[model samples]
Target: MQPSHTPHVLVVMGVAGTGKTTIGPLLAARLGVPYAEGDDFHPQANIAKMSAGTPLTDDDRAPWLDAIGRWAHDRAGLGGVVSCSALKRGYRDRLRAAAPGVAFVHLTGDRELIEDRMAHRKGHFMPTALLDSQFATLQPLAADEAGVEVDVSGDPTEITERAVAALAHLAPPQ
Candidate 1:
């Protein structure tokens, strides 16, 4: 399925444990676009801090966000999906600056559910304790923002399908 001319950029953004990693690829596959995991761009030091249970400062994230933004801009030429926390409006703005027509897909769910998932998850740098900081830093995308918000509390397939449908609706006619 080719993307519409409106240029939809899926930003699988949310606090830790929102399943951005898991859902991003599925959404991309459904959309027939490549998927980019935002965590892949994290600097080693940032990974170390998060692994040590420390919350990253905005300074720690700026370079990473810039990289993701650039990646999004580059990939959007052919169209693709990218997963990122994009926790702040400033960060989203930076992403938008890189790709003017980029859109977001904000995933949200209950804090307790997210924390539970974080605790059980392995091989990930982010810790469960940092969930608070993530939520604290998160500034939900405005209604008018170029994006759709979906609750990720349900099954992964359900979440993906909903997001895909939402994107289809938001996308311009082919």
Candidate 2:
């Protein structure tokens, strides 16, 4: 088990296929906090749009983002982890507005690597074809953001370990 510390609230932010779903839970498990899957907050219409290879408009994502933001706000009180495709700085900013000190773990990788992973992924609504749109819409996590950028080229365990290590400062003092 991890050493005792204060709980942390983090959003595993990235484009599809960046392994947010895979790594968020691992990080949560390691930290002994609950995990929230961001996708579950999406409206059916948004899922249908993405599943059909259409990118969601900002309007379409407004409620969804608000929902996740609210969740983050609530979870922060107890400290938890969540997976969110917080692709833009605005989206992350909204989350921050909801939960003042919430942190993020931005998973990233090259197009080739992400596309390769997407091509093989099964049962996910996001099509590989939309990867370009995701990339196009992405605004890299700003230097001033409260978070860490993790490369997704490694295995989930290694990636999660890196995230945990990077967030070491979040641990509450004994």
Candidate 3:
């Protein structure tokens, strides 16, 4: 399918280790758009909190979420994809406020698989110990949300293909 003219801002969203980082770029490439890694927008304090195994309060997350939201708005203006762990309804709402037409692609999987992925992963601030809290905080996207949910337990390429195809359907005709 050809790229759409609509402001195709896709947020690759989920709890940690759900392949947002892996699939986001590929999805962007498939759509011929740029991509942003949401983690880069987090403040050092927030990173430290997660690294220290403490969950961030909404107060702590608001600024970080706003930063990501602003980035999404900017990119949506130019049409792009973004990887974000927008774990709560409020967070997603904030993102929507910034980018009105933004769509989310939620990657979900079994907790065991996600925990295993987190345990073996490296150089990320969020620890596996925090997985439970992450899951606790996660308010999965509602059915009416403007996006698709893809099971990410399979191969990365397959997950990317699924996300790409889903986004393709949502994208406006070229």
Candidate 4:
């Protein structure tokens, strides 16, 4: 793809444990942009609910999505990458509405692999029990969505490389 100079924000998305968090910063660094942690946008109640192994309802996620949307909106033209479990099309739509130029990088992997990774993660509020709910909620990026899906089957660096390559068309030209 031919490169362009217009700056934009990329939301790295997927079900939990799909490596969105690990790949987002790597991609941002590769693209010479800043990175935001999507989880940081969550309110304390949301974190508490997730920590208790309860899957969040849409209402519970509204403020969190709005916060992330605002961040993306603010980063427009400045360029940034953020990690989020944007498992539903509606959530992504909300973000895109807030930041019209926002693109996405959907990290995907086998459920077994994701669950294994979740089981091994430390200090993360999300528990493995919520994996099924996340999967159930996931609606893969549709044909109309501005995004690319990268398989998270390899190491973080490898996945990041794949993401950088996949998303090159969206990045500003050097």
> Highest lDDT among the candidates is held by which one?
4
Candidate 3: regions farther than 4 A off: 171-174
- lDDT order of candidates, top first: 4, 2, 1, 3
Q: Candidate 2: how large is its RMSD?
A: 2.2
Off by over 4 Å in 4: 1-3, 170-174
Using TM-score, give the best candidate's number.
4
* Cα lDDT tens digits for candidate 4, 68-139: 999999988788899888899999999988888898899999999999999999999999999999988999
**TM-score of candidate 2 against the unseen true structure:** 0.93
Query: Model 3, range 1-174, lDDT digits (tens) per residue?
Result: 456466578889999889889899888887778888988888999999898999999999899889888987787657888888888989999989988878899999999999999888888888888888889999998976788889997888899888877776674412
> Where does candidate 1 clash, by residue pair?
none
CA lDDT of every candidate: 0.87, 0.87, 0.85, 0.88
RMSD of 1: 1.9
RMSD of each: 1.9, 2.2, 1.9, 2.5
Q: Pairs clashing in candidate 3?
A: none
**What TM-score does prediction 4 earn?**
0.95
Better of 2 and 4 by lDDT: 4
